[model samples]
Target chain A: MVCIDCSSSSATARLLPMSHQHVALRRFLRGPLNLRPPCCSFPRTFKTLTVHSSASPSPVLAASITSEASAKVIDGKSVAKQIRDEITTEVSRMKDAIGVIPGLAVILVGDRKDSATYVRNKKKSCESVGINSYEVRLPEDSTEQELLKFISDFNDDPSVHGILVQLPLPSHMNEQNILNAVCIEKDVDGFHPLNIGRLAMRGREPTFVPCTPKGCIELLHRYGISIKGKRAVVIGRSNIVGMPAALLLQREDATVSIVHSRTKNPEEFTRQADIIISAVGQPNMVRGSWIKPGAVIIDVGINPVEDPKSPRGYRLVGDVCYEEASKIASAITPVPGGVGPMTIAMLLSNTFISAKRIHNFR
Target chain B: MVCIDCSSSSATARLLPMSHQHVALRRFLRGPLNLRPPCCSFPRTFKTLTVHSSASPSPVLAASITSEASAKVIDGKSVAKQIRDEITTEVSRMKDAIGVIPGLAVILVGDRKDSATYVRNKKKSCESVGINSYEVRLPEDSTEQELLKFISDFNDDPSVHGILVQLPLPSHMNEQNILNAVCIEKDVDGFHPLNIGRLAMRGREPTFVPCTPKGCIELLHRYGISIKGKRAVVIGRSNIVGMPAALLLQREDATVSIVHSRTKNPEEFTRQADIIISAVGQPNMVRGSWIKPGAVIIDVGINPVEDPKSPRGYRLVGDVCYEEASKIASAITPVPGGVGPMTIAMLLSNTFISAKRIHNFR
Candidate 1:
């Protein structure tokens, strides 16, 4: 799916001038770029990257934009690039020293475009980090046993250091049972309940944290945004992003409140947050009025809303309206480049870690 | 540990007049009682039971009492008794029809008197419910291997339906490794991270929910307290209670918030809560002013402070000062009889469920 600012392509390349774009492009295409702050230098054309100035508000979404102050753009692409570069170097070091390559296996049950895009992105990230990627795509009507058979095969494959079954599997299959089949050691997605349980418990650490939430947390860490003892509010309580995000925040010692679909006054809770990471896929749900000024926002929601003026029928936007939050928030990650790139980068890092742990490659 | 209102004896017998006490005493003295509400009719005397009615508020802490509205006491003992008695009948029926009696094996690692008392009470409850209880007491300095050996044996035993490893194992042992050793099917205490993870997820059922939080929720259910669409604030972020309680509340569709030690102005959050469950161990931490009027308070903390007037050197008081909170809350659990006995009762219930599942003893 059109990963907006959360995409590393934008995180790393959003601020790149025309001249730097070529340098970034050449380095990225060559693979294994240097471990630098501006890491991801993908060469994709940003036809949809609409630049908004702090002085001017777009007429189309003018009602949503209330704050005049420009928020410091949290360059997730650069940070993800840096993390990917680190993983690349580590993977290379492990390969050179131990004669082993980190491998990740992806099992796709159905042909959902968004799921395909995510898997493709993950594979690309693995390649950049010198990790081997294996993929098995099944038709929509695949039986539960067929999916389980693939997972069982991967579980036994010594070369496969990590396994990820793309989520939202076809309605016929039982999701929990399938995910539970991936041996915990190879669970790179960190969707396993045990991993989540470990994450939720104080003084306990998970083998691998779920990628998106981990990325959101990594952004906060890299940006030096204080989370410990801060009042944080997580919107949405989904297992993948919101719940884990809240658990991660709690582990960081933040007093966390989770506001979800049943919440009577979600905005009231959001306004009390020192940090807000919203994963509800509602376009522009969190407005300037809901945010506490100077609060940090990490929007995980990437909703494609209809935009008749755009070349594409729809334009990608995060749960928070960027125009409004940018002015209100002291710092906020833009939709495409913010948390998106980090998810794939984390996947690569997890694969590298699994390989290291398996081989005792320290 | 001075088990107060949460104690079965006090819960079912505290309000019983002299003549009913004898009838209750006879029924409790017998091995297993019938499926009934107000089930726990133990003969534990009131030497430690200090009654503090609203008519005679303790002069020492009188300043904290502001509201005069008396709260409806949520008798956990009676509720726990009812649950236990129901289990008692089921166990008898299972034994007669299937010749399979549910057996629980508890492993205690330390010589802590409080832990011993808790174990004894658990064993007593098992007998009262017609469930067989097995005990393995190890020295304080027991090795990890020794503990695992017992767990493995229990796991293999055909008779054992449930297994529990008492918490606060000596400092020398690793807690997580030991707890993880218990087979998930027999994890009656439900401290297993996998069990906790299932509790956290939506549309997923845990093999067993942890006892304390399960008891708290059971109390709410029995009291006819609606958690759905309600605002719930769980104090403390402890794995055993606060976190699971929040997860359970969320599953029940309540908007849940976790307030911890690091939280700034926790009272502000508690005041907004329609249901407040303060599990933090600090004595009298949640004051009258902290609670919203007509809120339901489930004080899970059982802290002992010095009491010169009592026969025991110290008396048990919950996190919320009952004198103040009783007036402010619509319903409040007493320290001893509130959530204590329910913990043991749940252990029996989980065992019964395990036996039923294992033997298909319908």
Candidate 2:
């Protein structure tokens, strides 16, 4: 068994003696106490490591892991596989019992490579989960009326449980108008002004939550992070990421502060946070010095930087400087393996929730 | 000019020499900058004094002075009056030119004295603003469907630009159901789930902001409080007050933290704030020590505590320990004279805004 000492200069640390009683309690809570794993079964006896900065020489406590010695790494790929499997089972059961399969309709306008990749992945996820997928690809020159007609058609279709329009639509298309056209019930992206409004206001819960932020919270819950009364700082104020993340953090009883472009000395605020969720899309924007030692870091940025060793000549980087932050932060999620996978998982969860609501399923 | 230095118990300190130009600028911003003087305008300068405290010797700065040589009091009553006048003129103009009188439909269930008072004030404000007021007082035993049916009626009424259901309906009625019944466009109270969602989310603005919080921001803007980059701490997280106030503070570019029931050591957060908006409704919950010397205080609570000095045998108290806070705080809104009047003015403003949106008026 190896315990990574966060206070040490080395990437790894020595292992510590495990407490049998605590392990038993963790197992019980991760099993019977939780209704669903959201991904996979709980592992036993993972290593708890602390990373230390060479300059400070003081050990910072990172997250406690289970199955330290022989536990397989819980990467996004494996976790995503587990989620897809669970969803597949649930979808099949619903279909056999009620003759209803969840359906998602995607509308893509203009061929932006990134948008196309996202749409393709969504379609693939739908198929893996036994959800029927419909794709509507429009030409770059499609008129606003053309997009509206498709949205109106999907709105009336009872079989279509979710509707998502690829973002960054042609500059000429009124994004608001196109988005508003989607029926509230089918707004799986939760970008509808009404849904966004509901999410922002107190004493209200939206039918659908924006996927990315929901995913971040799910990760925290799965990892058993205590959020209540903790100080959480969300950097960036984008409609999709920073705003919703702050609201979610607040809902979970965290004292949340949102730092945006106008926020002076954001690092000061970030340094005080026990949890930092950065979605600014700036490469290595959050340095190790900005993080509070032992803080949980969720980096949502997916920037590509030059990497000569790779065939593509580039590697994906997170908004946070991972190598430096990993030494200070208690738990840090890597770029491609972090929030990205959770986004699709949350989308599937939202779809399942929508279906349950529509069918009045338990 | 006389400045009361509330920071010190002795209330004695040297007055800094203020240039004539500085005094003139302060006067212009506080007086004529207000489109209409809510009431009387005081002298440009009265007294300049500083208070010193052992904890922190920094003095609170005072801006305008009333006729009594008192520090400038934020006249919410007068400011609200000015807003109502503007709304009235707009309503009259709309009526004369477009043949439409902005109408507010209010539904009151049961006979809660406080709700009745609020409803009455709203009706009076509507009349004063030249907007038609529609009232429906339902019996205490009104069912959810009955209340929803009334909401539907208002939703369909073209003449009604705003719909507000006095909150705290009989326990039997589903609050969410009745609130959701109001169409988003006509939900002037901004309590509808959709509107609330928009208010909570980023990059989205609610068509109508909740009345009280909106009034608070309006008061700040009218009083020329610079919100940008300020540290704001809001006590409480009620949907109507704390939550919306935090969002508004964020909208104004302030770094806001919401301290609620679950918050530990709330005073620790409050003391760091440049502005404190307390709406917890707990009488005198916030003490002088919780405030920063120069912090602006907006007390939204109007709790009636036991005070047997008058015939009523009760006196109004705010969430803040006002007497002590007024001494320590740079600026404060008195309970009776602060947020109360602004609530009705905001309601009037919302009704007018709704009318303008519906009519597509410039």
Candidate 3:
């Protein structure tokens, strides 16, 4: 339960996990260039490098190499729980003060299993935090107009503080058209170009930062990792995770380089990074050799691979090779448990923020 | 005026000049983080290095080293003229086809000589391109409300295709407020957060790309300097030039990194770049050693320094030390004549585009 400062001598590497919820948004997962995925090998054996204590001088390097797991797992589930507890208190106070509960409306157009599971989890989380949750499920063949009508209704509803349209909307639906229709005030997903534009501009601020990237940054702040003046490299340039993540990092005064599929030598850029945020969906693509010693890693790619050992027949892994990265990085996020929980946590937080802003609540 | 490819054997280095127009926007010239300008030495002697032909194999390295000038100057004046010729033809065609002439309206609140000069140059450029031009001049003591009123008028004027408010408004006026008042549709300056957001997003296209950066990229395209997959470093994060320039480079599929004043060891990043775009307003801050052999240099900083030889008592210089950098770079833009003329060229282009879009001429 202890959160150790990443710089401390006793600190163990922490994994910043990728978002499992976004997996169903498969169409959006491709690199920004929409280039064919570069050839990559997966399920590779992990090898631990010799501990170069003097050369690296990392906190983990200074710590005793244990026979058990060396990385002190960053428990996102626990962190998320703590955040929810705090949010619950705030939600109660807002209700007591104003007699208005924050409301989040989700429009799920299709019944993809993963999308359904994500929406259900979000609803349950919303209810637990004392926020009102509204869901509208439509058949897979629904027209774009149908979705836009639902969004317009939610946007005008004074009680609804936030609106989210589950991604990878049916092929027939124009994603941008539907997403753009959601009023900027109710754009809890932060996918609207105007919000994104604000995020990119120097003096302007976005109403909401997209959830998963926001969570990745929150983890860094919570763990007290300094971003200012650091050389950071972001792998992938997806609109959701990688692009915004780089923008956020830059806003924090970090010198950032974006390495996408089109980038010829991604490892060369990653090797120079003090911090690396990888949202590319290729699991274990970032090998140990690609990392700088004592770097902070935030792997936003959660790819599932076959696992006969698991009851689900598959298990999730991050874009980074966790087994190898844990030994080299000062801190990292583990897949499944890391950024996945933080995404929903951030969505709830954003919803509360939206409601508070809308009502002029303190 | 042979526009030699940067990769050619006879390729001469081009100096990408920084914008002289933006210099008067002193308040906006400060870095994004509002960090104090880093203490930097200037007006240093430019020393040429020994030509090691086999070591670098650069085109300039392979070409006969001339004593008078080792690098071939990139004539921004000529290139801009060529682009204007192309644009003029387009404007004539559109006018003939639709009976609509592109009109550009400029709002100049203060009487700063530089701003006035820039506006006049733009007006003249518009005239040369057969686009209608409008000018509104107000006293230096004019209120922001007065400026906003003018902008609102221009916004409503269907004949005014593009609207530009001269920068560095009076100290009492809020710059962002005034800039935001201009309708996004008519914002030829591309300073609108929405336009910036669209520029940053993966698939969305901005109504207008900021002129100076657009000009810099245009110069690159004209010269056939490949941007895709190249390591490009943009120094300075000023909203007008540096930030947009980085985004533009990234959109071209280059692996882009932004180095601001807060960035430690700026040379380290610049040294790694195949293309270096220096927009920081410090004169000659980037030296030859900071550049990689055969790297393309785009100097967007036009800083004034004392020069007894000049009739005006001062001369303009770029952020990069031209004398030293030319030998190392494959191409560069010279100060005053480089990005300066290109900025006006781009403004005319954007204005034409705005008019075309408004009329649905294309």
DockQ of each: 0.30, 0.31, 0.41
Span of ten consecutive residues with least summed lDDT in model 3 chain A:
A2-11
Q: Rate residue B203 of model 3 by lDDT.
A: 76
TM-score-sorted candidate list, best first: 3, 1, 2
Residue range A175-228, candidate 1, lDDT tens digits: 889999999999998989999988888767899998889999999999999998
Measured with C-alpha atoms, the lDDT of residue B67 in candidate 1 is 31
- Residues B218-334 of candidate 3: C-alpha lDDT, one tens digit per residue: 999998889997889998777788889999999998989998756776666776788999887666677666676778999877776655545865566777777667767889999
Worst 10 residues of 1 chain B by lDDT: B54-63
What lDDT does candidate 3 reach at residue A356? Answer: 97
Q: Write the per-residue lDDT of candidate 2 for residues A1-362, one digit (tens) a residue.
A: 21211222222211111232122212221111112111121233334455432222122333333232222122555566677788889999899889888889999998876677778889999988989889999999999999999999999987888998887678899888888899888898887767776776555677898888888887777778889978888987666777888888987889888877666656656766788998765556676657767788888766655555558665666667665567567787876788778888878877877787899877
User: Which candidate would rank higher by DockQ, 2 or 3?
Assistant: 3
Models 1 onward score TM values of 0.81, 0.79, 0.86
Q: Looking at model 3 chain B, which ten-residue stretch has the lowest summed lDDT? A: B1-10
Please give the clash total of every predicted structure, in order: 24, 36, 17
**Complex DockQ, candidate 3:** 0.41
| Candidate 1 residue-wise lDDT, B1-362, digit = tens | 32222222211211122233223222221112212222122223312212233221111121234435489999999999899889988999999998998999989897877667767888988988899999999998889999999999999999999998876678889878898899999998787888888888766799988888899999999999999878899987777777899999999989888887676656657767889987755556676656666789998866665555568655667767676678668899998789877888888889999999899877
Rank ordering of all candidates by lDDT, starting from the highest: 3, 1, 2
TM-score for chain A as predicted in candidate 2: 0.79
lDDT of 1 at B317: 70
User: How far is each candidate from the true structure, as Cα RMSD in Å?
Assistant: 12.8, 13.0, 7.7
